[model samples]
Structures are given as C-alpha cells and as structure tokens.
Target chain A: MEKKNTQQEIEEEIKSKGKDNIIKKIFSWILKNVKFLLIPASRLEELSIRQIEYEKKISKRKFIRRMKSTLTIFGMLLIFFIVTIAVFAPWFSPYTFDVLVGIAPGNYDPPSPAHLLGQGRLGRDILGRIIYGARASLTIALPSILFSLIFGVIFGVIAGFYGGWADSIIMRIMDILLAFPGLILAMVFIAMWGQHMEYIMLAYGIIGVPYYSRLIRSSVVQSRDLPYVQAAKVTGAGNWRIMFKHILPNCIQPVIISFTFDIGGIILSLAGLAFLGFSDPQLIEWGNDIADARLHLYEAPWGAFWPGFMILLAVLGFMLLGDGLRDALDPRLRNIYGAKKKKRKKGKKEENDSYEKK
Target chain B: MTLIEEKTEDSDRDPEVILSVRNLRTYYPVLGGLFRRKIAEVKAVDGVTFNLYNKETLGLVGESGCGKTTIGNTILNLVSAKSGEIYYKGVRIDNNFTNDLRKKIQMVFQDPDASLNPRWKIVNIIGEPLRILERMKKTREIRKRVLELLETVSMKMEHLDRYPHEFSGGQKQRIIIARALACNPEIIILDEPTSALDVSVQAQILNLLKDLQRKFNLSLLFITHDLSVVQHVADRIAVMYLGKFVETGTIEEVFYNPTHPYTRALLSARPTFDPTTKTSRVILEGDVPSPINPPSGCPFHPRCPKYLEQGKSMACSEDVPKKIHLGGEHYIWCNQTK
Candidate 1:
C-alpha cells in the first residue's frame, strides 16, 4: 500500500511539470507576437493625443464663436429652411405640383386660403411647385459644381506642377475654353446634347471647369518653388509626391473659397437656362415656373413673385456662407474672429527662455 | 615659429577626401527680348575647385551674391553644373547622383520659415526622409524613429503635432536640422543656417550643430557671411570672391596670415571687441561686379586694394592668376600673393 502511494505522488509531479512546460511555450509565443497588436494600440493612443492637442490649440469653440455673426447665422437659417421644405415636399405641400384644380378664370386666382401662394395659369398649386423646385435646383447645382471641382483640380495640378511642355498644353486648352463666353458655350452644349435636365447640368459643369482650373493653376505656380519643395526634392521624393502631397495642401485654401462662391453662380446659370426654355417644359423648376407665370403677371403677380423670391434666397445663402468662410480661412483675418492671441505670446516667451538657457 | 611649422606639417599629412569638386562652372541663362531667348549667362559658380576632408567643417565665407549659396546648390545638383566633375567617395555624382548618394547627402536651407512646409505637422516633415529613403512604411516605426531624431535635436514628443507656423524661428531651424539628420547623411550642406536667428539663438544653434557633428562624424560645408561665426566653428576656411575661391587654408593659416588681397579685406571687415587697440579697417571700394558680365582676369581686380597698391599692374586685368601654394594646404589665386 505504501509503494502504491509513492508511485501516485511521482506521477502527479510529472503531470504538473508537463503543464508548466505548456504554459511557458504559450507565454513565449505571446511575448513574440504581442508587439504587433500593441503597436497599433499605441498608434491609436497617439492619434487621440494629437486630436486633443489640436482641439486645445485650434479650438472649434472659437470657430463657433466666429460663426455667431448675424450674416452667417441668417445664411445658415435660410439654407436650413430651404432644405427642410425640399425634403418634406410630399407631406407639407398642400397639393400635387402638376394636378389641375380649376378651369378658366378660377385657375389664375390670386393668394387665397385654399391656394396659399395662389394657383398657376395651368391650375397647379404654386406653393407646392416652388417647394418641389428646391429639390431640382439643388440636384443640378451640387453635382455639377462637384464635377467641375474634381476635374479642374486635376488639370490645374498637372499643369502647374509639371510646367514646361505639359504646362503649355494644358494651359492652352484652358485658355481656349475661357475664350468663349460661359453662357454662350453652355447654350451651344445644350443645343447639341438635347434639352434634358442631365444634359443641362453636364453643360454647366463643363463651363465651370476652366475658371476653377485657372485659379488653382496660378496659385500652384506661385507655391511650387517654395523652399519646402526643394527640401522634399532633396529627401528623394518623386515629382508626384511633391506636387500632390506638399504643393496641393498649401494652395487648397483659395480653391475652397472659390468653390463655395461658384455654387451660387452655377445655380443662377441653371435658372437662366431653364428660363430661356433650354430645359424640358414638363420639369417643375423655379425658372420654368417663373417663365410660365410671366404672361399672367399682370393678372396674378404672386405666381411670378414667389418663384423669383425663392431663387434669390438660395443664391444669397451661398454667397453669405462664402464670405464667412473667406474671413475664417484667411490667417491674417482669423485673429479678428475671437481666436486666442495668448497662445502666440506663450510660444514667444518659451522661445526666449530657451535662448537664455542656451 | 616651431608651433606654426608643426601645424603646417599636420595639415600636410593626407586625410581622407570624401568630396572633390574639379573646375565646376554653373551658369544661369538670362532670358530677354520678345521671343525670350537666352541673352546672356550669369556665371554663378565659375571655375571653383576644392576638396572636402572627412569629419571636418569647411567654412565658405563670402559677401551676399558672391555665389557661396550657388556653390552649395551646385554640389547637391539642385542646379546643373555647366562644366565640371564632382566625385563623392571616388564615384562621379554630378547630374548622375543615385538615390543612395542622395540619401547620403542632405541640405539645411537658410530660411527656416521657408524650408518647412507650413501645412505639414512636425512629425511628417521629419519623417519624410525616413519614409522616402529608409522606406519605413509602418507608422509606428516611423513615429518611433522621428521621436528619437527629435530628442537628438532637443525637441519633445509634444511638438510632433504642431504646424510650422506655431513654432518660433529657432524651433523651426531645429526641426529642419532634425529632418536633415533623419537619413543619417555623411555630409550636410548648411546654407546660412544661423543667419536668420537672433544672436543668442544663433549661438545655441551653432553649438548644437557642433555637438551633432562630433556625434555623427559628419562633414559639414558651412556657408555663411558671418565672419565671427565661421571663426568659431570652421576647421578650415575658404574665402570666395565673385564666384571664385580667392583663398583657401587651415583656419589658423588664413586667420593669422592671410595671403590673398581679398582675404585681407574681408578679415579686416570683422568687428573687433577690444577698445584699446586701434586697427585700420580695409573698406573695399565699389560694389560686387555683375555676374552676367564679370570683369576679365581676376573678378576682384577692379576693387582689389593690392591691385591699386601695385600701381594697377597689367597682369591683374589681362591674365587670370593660377593657384599659388603657400605650403601645407594654404593656397591663393592671386598674382600678387607670392
């Protein structure tokens, strides 16, 4: 019985030693592979620290304070109201934009309780058509402007960054585009492609490319020879990396300001084209409504007045926003908009202290 | 006299040559007329030759527009050399520098504000070299290396996220230095690195550069117009005049026994601190001649005081003088030197 007990104790000790070996092997594997996971984790922590620092230094709180100005606030509210009206047009509008409700004299009725913004000559509800027009106007303007911005930046960066032969070829093409009057060129494009909404937007988008390209090109030319560019070159950076990475970011501020302002201009152009019967007459656009109401203006003025006022409000909203962005983005003017001046002073004091310590 | 002899003998002993520029000439085309033709050529770096030894600082002192910066630029192939051969580690590199050679040689530009990209954070600016040359794709590894470089330059990790505009001029310069050192270059051409800083800041930068040189065993081509700064840091001095080396020597040889007339004029222009001893200043007459049409023979003949003292010798204007060796490594390109 005593020998059996001693044998059991030896087996248990051997079993425990094997378990210890397995544990050691697992720990060794983890020690070797854990850094890959830990590195990314540390990177995430560093990124958060960077974000926090950025917030402390260039606080969005200051941007909010600057945006509190009356003009910008008014612009934001106008845009907000227009977007809401467009989104809920099916629910909020009193009647279908196209269905007729009356005949003859009753169709051209002035502002009344049943028809709040009155009825059109075709007997469609004017308020409903105007509310729906916001959707059409935005769909055309936003896409067209975005298309122009993307293509224009590509052409401009290629021209300015490469210079020499590439510059000459691209710039000459842009010059040829600029030579023709914008509206006339757009009209010619629409005439060839047919008067559908998509074609009109495409024409407008093509017309805007040269203006943005030229603006970006001139600024890029000025910044291409800065000392930072030379520094990058010395570090073995290729031409593409220098052009897109270094030169583009520094010169993008002016492009952004121009981008905001160009949206307003494109919307006006789209309206002008619609008003001239360049679009399909069935489309319920603001300019199309204005055109149909012109003949009945003497009888029911609200028909012409409402659509024109909506157009004005859209354009004014974008223009005010552009002006506010210019004030915010320009570093020289940023201090006037409640940015903390004390940070710069502290930096200077630290510089002085370092100098003394040395 | 024996100490001076020993110094000359020490310089004569052959040191390793890391870079040698032979008869380098760089010209900039001047465009004019309606068709924008090349009307003339500005001789920016005209027929300059020198050898840079390993682990030494060669101070290049010249007035503004005398082509000191042009020489540095030409060596880095930033500008094409019209006629010359530049050998680095015994391999020809003019206009044919490989990516490896480019990694080995770097530059610190004069204006700190201009050298750094305003839009980039400090980490990206310094990490640029490590990314391109070292091919460090992992952000964690790059951040770690950049942190190490920043520490070498006495900057902290907290500065990694800030833009160039937020930093002071001295801080910007330190960041630029840190960027230059990221690739572990053997030679660094510093173009007036401290000229843009205040006097106290200048001293700090100079000392930092000295410490970095000792630590890295770097060969520095220090280009500046500040005589006192050069005197403090340079192992050897090369005095340039009108895109040419007028004199070259060990610092002791050039400082105490200047042979070239141009060298004498430049040294006398340095401000002395002692109030008791009155030293005569050699104020050079006339402005630096136009590089587009530099004067024949010696470029400095028109303003050379020694030329006037020698009663306007015909040799000064008619013929270019050859290099005259004054024992050891001391040499001057002046007919009146011997």
Candidate 2:
C-alpha cells in the first residue's frame, strides 16, 4: 500500500513544482507581509504572543516581592554606571592607570581637590587607575569568557551527540582539566604562557572550558531526546544538521547563563592573579591598585574604596542579569507566569464539547 | 467452527505488494560507561514483517511498548536498526538511500509541543527542507507556496511569521501538518499525533489528516495505541504484540472477527458502545514482560484464552507456532489456528 502513495507524491511533485518553489513562496509571503511580521503582524495575535517573551508573570501582589528580593534600582544603576565608566574610560579619565598626571611629584597630602582619590604607592592617580581598571577588567573578562564559551560549546556538542568512545575521550580530558581548581589552573597557565593580555585570556578560557562543556553536554543530552530531534532525523536531516539546527538551539539557555557567570569569575580570577604578584605592574589593573594601596589603606583609604567598589558593581550586575534570565527562560518558571493579561479562547467545537460534558 | 467462515478470506486484496519486510528487528541495547558493556537489549521491534500496498492506511495497533512505535521508527530509520531490511519502491533501503527516500515519506510525531521546535518561526519550520533538498523557484515563490499550504491546512496566511509558542495546541498540530505536507510526501506515518491533544482538538486534527490524505491521495502508516482511532483511517490493520505481528488483515476482518488470541483479547478490552451486547473487560493479567528474556513459547500464550499446548506451545514451552495462513491474506500466528 505504501507503493501507491509514492506515485501520488511523485505526480504532485511533478505537477506543482519542486520543494524549492514551496520554500520561495513562504519567503515571499514574509516579505509582502513584513509590516505584521514584527510580533504583532502575524495571525497569532493571541494575547500571549503580544506579551514580551521573557517577562516573568507573577501574582500582581507577589510581583512586588519578587522585585524586592532581586537587586534594587540603586544597585542596578550603580552597576550600569560602573560599566559605562569602564566602556568610556579613555574619555572619562585623562590619565592612564600608571600615568601620574599631577601631584607635582611632591605633596601627597590629605584628600583634596585635583586628585579626587589621591595617589597610590607609585604616586599614580588613584581615580585614574580605578577608571582605567574598569576598562582593563571588562576587556579581559569579556574576551576570556567568550573564548571559554566558544571552545566549551564546540566540545560539549561533540561529546553529547556521539556518546561512545569519542564522548569518553573528550569527557576524560575535561575531567583532567577540571581536577585543578579553576583559579589554580588559570594561574598555572598564565605563569606558563607568560603574562600578556592574550595569555591571560587563554588561561581563563582553558580553565573555564570544563564548566561550560559539562553544562552544554547535559543540555545537549536532554535536547537530543526531545521529539523534535527525532522528527528531524526521520525527515532525513543528517547528524551535523541535527546537531546544529535542532539540538544546539535548546542548549543556548545554560550557555547564556554560564557566560554571565564566566565574566564575573574571570574578573575575580584575573584580579586574584594580579594581587598574587603575577600580573605585570605596568598593566595598572584593579588588582594591582588594591595591592599598591594595601600598605597605606588607613591613610589613603580612598585608593582601596574606589577600586573595590567598581569591582563589586561589575560582578553584581552580570549576576543579577543572569538571575533575571534564569527566572524568565527556564520553562517551569515561564509556565508559572502564564501571561496574566489574557487567556486564549477555545475553538467553537472545543467550547461545545466542554459545554456538553458540563 | 471458525468465527470467520472459510469462504471470505481468499477473495480480497491484490497479489502485488508495494513494500514488504521479512524478519525485521530493532533492538536498543541499554549500556553503561567506558567499556560500554551491553547491559540488556530492549527488543523494541523483533522479527516482524508485513507488506504495505499502495494507497492504503495500514493501522499498526498495539498497547504502549508493544513495538508499534519502534516498527514505525525503524521503517523511517529514525532509530538505528539492529537488523532490518526496509524496501522502498522495490529497492532495499539502507542508510545511503534513506535521505533521498525521505521525500517520499514523512512522520507526524506524538507530542505537538515537543515535535515543533519553539525557536523556528512557522515559515522556517515549513520551508527549511525546500532549501535543503529540492531545487526550486525564487524566495517569493516559496513564501507564496507556504501561505497556500497554510490555507490548505485551514490556517491563515497571517500565521507565517510567528513562532510556534504563539499558537494553541490544535494550531501547533495544524502547523506540523503543514510542515509535513511541505515535502509533498506520499506516505505519512502518524505516530499517535492526536494522543497528546484534547478530545475536541483531537477530532479536528484527525479530520484534517483525513481530508489531506484524501485530497492528496497520500498513503498513511498510522501507528497508534488507541484502537478506536484507526477504525476510520486504515483500510487494513496489523495488530502487533511484543515486537511481532499476530494478525494482519482488512480492518473489517480484524475488528469484526479477530482471529489471533491477543487481538481478540485487545478487542474484548475496548468497551462496546452497544448496550445490549456487553463485553466482560477481559484484562490481560500481569505486566508486559521485559524484552530481554521473553517467555519460551508463544509470547502471548501466557495470556491466551484459546491457546492449547499439544506440548508444542505451552507444555515444555519449546516449539513456537509459525504464522498460519487461513486462506486469503488473513494470517495468524497462534497454535489454535489449526
């Protein structure tokens, strides 16, 4: 019986045109209907679709409690301010971290005008170092975390899909890499590679790989089992296509969350390495400033406070963002929120069935 | 005296068959780490074969884990088969031809939520394969075709750009059907497509599937655990048990005068709407045995009501009964057939 359908399928294929035409048709429709294409334009004008996808739905009263538990407006603004300062450090601070702009190479008196946070051990402007350090820390952490995500996602994808000898080999390597504590491993690699910005990034990437690999690997395992993956396979999508197209999209949740934490961790680890006297002093980073200010902290407490405050804000911001994302993207949490504004109406038949059943 | 008299079996059905399987087997081995020792093999589909003729819906009905799903998956090569020869268009199907052969075949999965990728907009979900395999017209053409497909499936043109989450469960399934129809496939193997839906949604999807099948003249390999569903769709029925088919015949023959012992028990289990002729609700005692170490004789002999040993089936539980052909194409694998 399966034979006859093949004839009909062939005939239809021959008559109307090939699959390419069908695909073209869909694309054209989107182009023509571009106005509605943006969330509201489509036929799915159901109330749920109109809502911003990741917003958390909570009881109106309970909503206040949720916001209360997370970072407040002041904290968020502080984080944003710190990030902006770091991004615009060149414009914000006329002096580089090491550039002792003005103290006339003499009078390192009490906190006063001109030098806002005063000078440190090398008589470098403390304000200059703190602002420059934000730039230094962000560049280092963002790039380092990015490398980690890239290699980790690649390794994780391979391990999750193959699941046999290849999986064993890759996982064992991750286990070996994971044996050393993340900070210790980063320190060792930085020491071996010799301390350049690139070397530090390399160190952070290597050390962070195992965490993302394990995370993405687990996500891939779950995603591979979703019926859509199997459906893709039955429809003749190859292994690579299935891995990238079907399985990989679902793994984005954890990878995104880990990226937030990786940035924070990278900042701490890089600073810790710098404080341990590994970082080149010429770099004039957050950690180096903290180290320089340690001796005269009581006298020039401003030196310690600015650098410490900036570090706290950057780390806290990424974390809060990640926490907000976790609550929104996690399926269980989204279901709880159920978009309170509107409920979908049942079709006539469905309404009638319920009516009859009632 | 046979429930079905001898005269009617031999006269129906054509001699020519479209696709036929001999001894099909698909066993998934449960394993552990490192050395990867095979702990136990779940014989999801074991030693099953039946011919599928053209232009007919063959309902492969059985309880869950009875291997009806495995049979469909194996046929489509979704799950790797331990040993099976799936022929397509008189050609033996291996992994190589499986890709090209897929255009002719498609499957609608059980869960609409799990089956449709949430990230992909409706257009990509339907138009992706057109970009992959077939060489076709411009982007404008494919877009129009998709809208036409949406219209054909009773969906609006406006739904093209939205994501899967925007639609209701029924709409999701309709989009899934639109996607399946995109390849313009000849055979659609619906694996419990309606089971995950509400009754009202279920009726609509079923009706849509029927309408599409008739309109397009598509062949369907409808795999379902629900016996009531296949009645309207399948022209023929193949009742599966523990990875093997116990009965294969016309729908009328299987439902009206079910010959195989297991088939009869299953039929007996479905409550009759007729208030006058009551069914006893004969429960098949005990859980389905693990596929690893199945019973010695007939797999269903432990639960068979009409079974007799002759020392061949139940006695020493040694010799297994072969599939007995009782005229026409009404075949049954049971010791009592003789």
DockQ of each: 0.43, 0.28
Fraction of native Cα contacts reproduced by each candidate: 0.71, 0.53
Across A1-358, the per-residue lDDT of candidate 1 in tens digits comes to 1455687888997898777877798988888668756676553454443344455555522456556567877888888888888888777887764453234346768778988888887677788888888888888888888888888888999898888789899989988877776667668877787766677677777777888788889889999889999999999898889988989877777777777777767766766776676766566677677777888888988888998899889877876776676555433344543547554656655554565455
Candidate 2 structure quality by residue, lDDT tens digits, A118-212: 76665667777788787788888888788878898889999998887888899999999888776676677767877778877777778788888
**TM-score of every candidate relative to the true structure:** 0.83, 0.81
Model 1: docking quality category: acceptable
Docking class of 2: acceptable
Best by DockQ: 1
> Candidate 1: TM-score?
0.83
Please state the Cα-based DockQ of model 1 relative to the true two-chain complex: 0.43
lDDT of 2 at A346: 33
Q: What are the Cα lDDT values of the candidates?
A: 0.81, 0.72
lDDT of 1: 0.81
